[model samples]
Target: MAEKIPAGGTDHPGRGDWPVIPDEREADLIGLDLLDHADGPDLVLFLAGNQFMAVPELLEAFRAAHPKVRRIFCETLPPRLELRQILSGGAWFRGRLVTVVPDCWATVSEAGVAALAEAGRTERGQCRAYLRNRVVCLVRAGNPKGVAEVADLARADVVVSQPSPVHEDIAEHILAMYRAAGGEALAARIMEEKREAGTTLLTTVHHRETPERLLAGTADAGPVWATEAAHAAALGLPLEAVEFGEGLDQRGRVRYFLCPVRGGAHPENGRAFMDFVRSPEGRAIYAKYGFLPV
Candidate 1:
């Protein structure tokens, strides 16, 4: 079983705070936490990893379109972890005394959505693609290692911060892209040889740690979703996105899909939130944060 998120831990942000009212500061709220129904949020979301930057904007737009949904709570976890939590009906978040189920769930991998459907976790015919993205390399500002593309990741001189394939789907995408560029030899070298030599570092929370590693000068570069790199740049962080050429960076579009959870307490509001996410306004909000509209 996957490790449970320790409830009420201050080590990571968004532990105890949840069911927040949408406000101008929404975009700045990027922490994962548990929610309590005692306050009664109108809608709750269990979102896939790496959407920390776009969700707040999406929530704000959702509120504007549906004023009735005044409170929204969300938990952003790795898709597999989120799926496991959904299957189990609730998760034991750090510091949280009880488990809480969400009304809606979104994942970057369609496979995750399919898993939920196969498990009868979502309402039938309710899932849809909402946003698109691609992969890229995130390097420290000025790109100290002079890394430019996926191929350079294979270089002996370029130390890399890599995500764990076991934990994040994006990690598999990265390995595949590397294979496409230089075959399995490249993938093996990075995943095995370089990893053993400490030239390739693995991250526990891929998306969050990429920028942290870069800023801390612990890694020369790391593969990440384009939006993640963009979010870091938008925040004026000392990081730069290095785009890969065609057939190299997993340029074949990745996607974000959402569905209302079946048997959830707030089915009506759940469907409404899904509709708002697919609306033009929702797409615009995603686009503003570097997501390509589906």
Candidate 2:
């Protein structure tokens, strides 16, 4: 059977005991393109998948600061895929269904932000750093895999789950970390050899599926953002974080960037949201969820 993508932070309320969106059912409708029964969202945010845990608190602050803005739509997915959807104005859902375009966008790397600007998707000047994070290995509680470091992922006995480099910017960092820890041969072993042997499973949505793979015993460990692992533990999920050695894991180096989409449907709202994400109050909310704010 093929692996299923978990419902994601969209359905469940997160670690802060706050819902990313006010209503799961309503968010589901929008995600599924099933309902046009209500007014369109005031602000639509396209964000990196790893930041899902902070959405509820971020949205709460956005609402408190801008009370007039009521229906906000936030979509979190891999940055590369999200950028493609943004450039094309929409994304194909189940069987060619198109979802609505978002007003603003945020990515785990500045590369996506730069690409958007270069491609004329978003204004270059408006893009800025929003938050920070680092790579970490998420494992089953108590570290049953004995994955003490990045190199351990290369062991024959370990089965690892990794995100697709085609869609996730984090994949690049993970690969670089692997190369730093061992060498290109080791990187190839895990990225190619082990993958061909079914020992390193590739995930479509890293943030949402990695934890599930760990819980299901299908994946012994996976590289993910430190904040994501923290969020999982905070929610009482059976997962533990394994910090990697400096210079190898790229710890204290990852920076997330955000921008207002050019020619967006709600340019004003996009600007407001861009500002809100950088606001002191907004940074505090993200910090509460383990995200390192700018």
Best by the TM-score measure: 2
Clash number for model 2?
A: 0
Q: 127-155 in candidate 2: lDDT tens per residue?
A: 88888778889999999878897778999
Spell out the clash pairs found in candidate 1. Answer: 5-94, 6-94, 7-93, 7-94, 7-95, 7-96, 8-94, 8-95
| Candidate 2: residue 266 Cα off by (Å) | 1.0
Q: Tens digit of lDDT per residue, candidate 1, span 17-67?
A: 332212332232233332433465667777766877777777788888888
lDDT of 2: 0.75
lDDT scores of the candidates, listed in order: 0.72, 0.75
How close to the true structure is residue 43 of candidate 2, measured as C-alpha lDDT? 75
Runs with alpha carbons beyond 4 Å of true place in candidate 2:
1-39
The number of the candidate with the highest lDDT is: 2
What's each prediction's TM-score?
0.83, 0.85
